[model samples]
Target: MRKILIVGAGQSGLHLALGLRAHGYAVTLMSNRTPDEIRNGRVMSTQVMFHTALQHERDLGLGFWESQTPRLEGLGISVADPGHGRAVDWLGRLDHYAQSVDQRVKMAAWMETFAQRGGQLVIHGCAVSDIDYFADSYDLVLVAAGRGELVSMFGRDPARCAYGTPQRALAVAYVHGAEPRPEHPGVDAVRCNLVPGVGELFVIPALTVGGRADILFWEGVPGGPLDVFHGVTDPDDHLAVVLQLMEQFTPWEYARVLNVELTDPGGVLAGRFVPTVRRPVASLPGGGLALGVADVVVANDPVTGQGANSAAKCAAVYLEAILARGERPFDAEWMHATFEAYWEQARHVTKWTNTLLGPVPEHVERLFGAAGRLPQVADRIANGFDDPADFEDYFYDPERTDAYLARAAAASAWPGVRGARRIRGA
Candidate 1:
């Protein structure tokens, strides 16, 4: 039996563990804290899993969505020009696209499934030290530690990479039951609003085990006097600025939940703005001859809300590669190629999303401007999420854009109007 040791009990770690065990591997999962402790203490982050990623979960028979996730019908996106206090709504829905799942719940589900599969899970904290790979102590050591010390092994040299300026600071707070304000009436769940120069804010409905509704505010802080808001020590004061900015930037309906309180007192829910960066994959001293599987190798910005989905997708791919090699000697070349394949698949999507969130590029701005004037164009953009390949298709293939744009233009024309003629004449 192949013995696999997984470090960190986060979503990625748990997913990989359950996957390996199901394949008949002997898996031992270790984490620093007990499951209950991690569940109760950790602050929940907003995670939106796309349809493709969900399919992977279902194929793995994880059954996470049957009970835990909130099915979201569509996305409500608003673009605002804060300086002029002008905002426009760009609404789109997918028949079967994405769902919001509580990170904590997802983690718990994976852990439970891993255990039921006869996988050994150890709660004792174990710090991994540098080791000789040829020693037959273990078959694989996978690291899924997020933002932990183990990441140092794969860390990149800062001097070699070109990093962009930090766009905006993000402050997230999980609050319970501040009723949706009038502007945000009948708000069933997730909403994203752009505050122009100020930044973008997302309000997502959270699913907690207690059935109490939770609110997550992802506020973007652009440079200037607004930068001071980043330093405010008081949560109330910080929240006030968020509300004021929202009210000024857009005609958003938001209810102030007077009774709502934060889950954390010290404001551990916050994280600062950081440029999105990816470290090139490095081959660890492992071939099938060596005992140790590569752990978490990818780190992405949460701006696109693809972190969880990407992690899950990568896990699935990695699982396939492992199963393919079977008991054969682990070929270092093949393992590196497997990692690169997943990275190549994910890079385009990540870049497209980051570009969208960063200062709107001219081409994108023009595209949106046209989309606003042309409903058909808007539909194509909206349906972009439904495309199986998503941004990947749009980014990697220049030809695909033209085809998509043509379809968009055609769809945008008002009923009875010839879109081809309209574009030809213009």
Candidate 2:
């Protein structure tokens, strides 16, 4: 049996371990944190798995859907003009094909399933250092070690990367028993608001276990923002500030939130700014290879919430290539080809998502503008997440640009308005 050592216990690492074991590979998954540590650790971001990712979960028979920390049937997108104190529900009840779960619960469930599948998981105290690979340590070593110092071992010149300005900082808080508005049942569970010039705020309910909800706020800080504890340090004071900010953005709807009491004293509220980076796959000296995956490969702004989905897709593609080359020498040529294939598949989605987060490109802006006026156009965009073929078109073929644009234009033009405009312009 071929032996494999996976260097991280994150989502990709865990999924890979399970996939390899199913294929009759002996795998030793190593991580720095134990299951208990991950379970009790502070919850970070929320992940909405696309249909393809969900299929992977089911294919592995992980059986995690029923125990999902939360489930959302639809998504709501709004644009808030904080300066005018007005919010427009730009897109409501869109994207019905996706579901979200707390990152913590998903991780815990994955670890449990991996262990039950006879996969060996070792929680070493810290990261593993450089060891002689050819010394017969293992047949293969896969590095899924996320974005950190661990990425440097692959030895690539950092100067070759294209870096962009840091995006806004994000602060997320989880609270329990937060009542919902009668008019907007479970609104918090699926709503995302783009407050231009400021940032975006997403209220995702039940993102954690025990009926807890997440209040995610992103602010575009070219430099940074003044430290404002949203009652995290002091409930009475921070709560006041958080409510004030919410009311300032969506007074008519969020006013009710001011009355809700925060019950979790130990609940999480934290912030950080993320810089976007993209680098080419680097080849190691000894015909071994090191390539970035997930956020490390293409760091996308969370405003689009496509990180987890993209990572899952990347892992799936990599797994396919590995299986295809069974027992083949893991040489530089094979590694380069695999990395190229993965990139080709992932580039389109990554670019589209990243562009959506940045100042909207003209084509995308036009699409969104038309979507606002056309329900069919809006539905197409929402349904695209569930249809991998549509996603591929959007990413892989620039020629489809006009087709998408035409659809948007047709949707945007009112009855009789198209002819009238053409006549007038002519």
TM-scores vs. true structure, each candidate: 0.80, 0.80
lDDT per residue for candidate 1 within 244-269, as digits (tens), equals 55455544434454455665543225
Model 2 clashes, total count:
2
* Steric collisions counted per model: 16, 2
Worst 10 residues of 1 by lDDT: 417-426
Model 1, runs deviating above 4 Å: 65-68, 83-86, 130-135, 157-167, 178-189, 212-214, 219-268, 273-296, 372-376, 379-389, 392-407, 413-426
In model 2, the worst 10-residue window by lDDT is 417-426
**Which sections of candidate 2 miss by over 4 Å?**
67-70, 82-87, 92-96, 125-135, 154-162, 181-189, 224-243, 259-291, 361-366, 385-426
Quantify all predictions' global Cα lDDT against the true fold. 0.58, 0.58
For candidate 2, give the lDDT of residue 137. 61
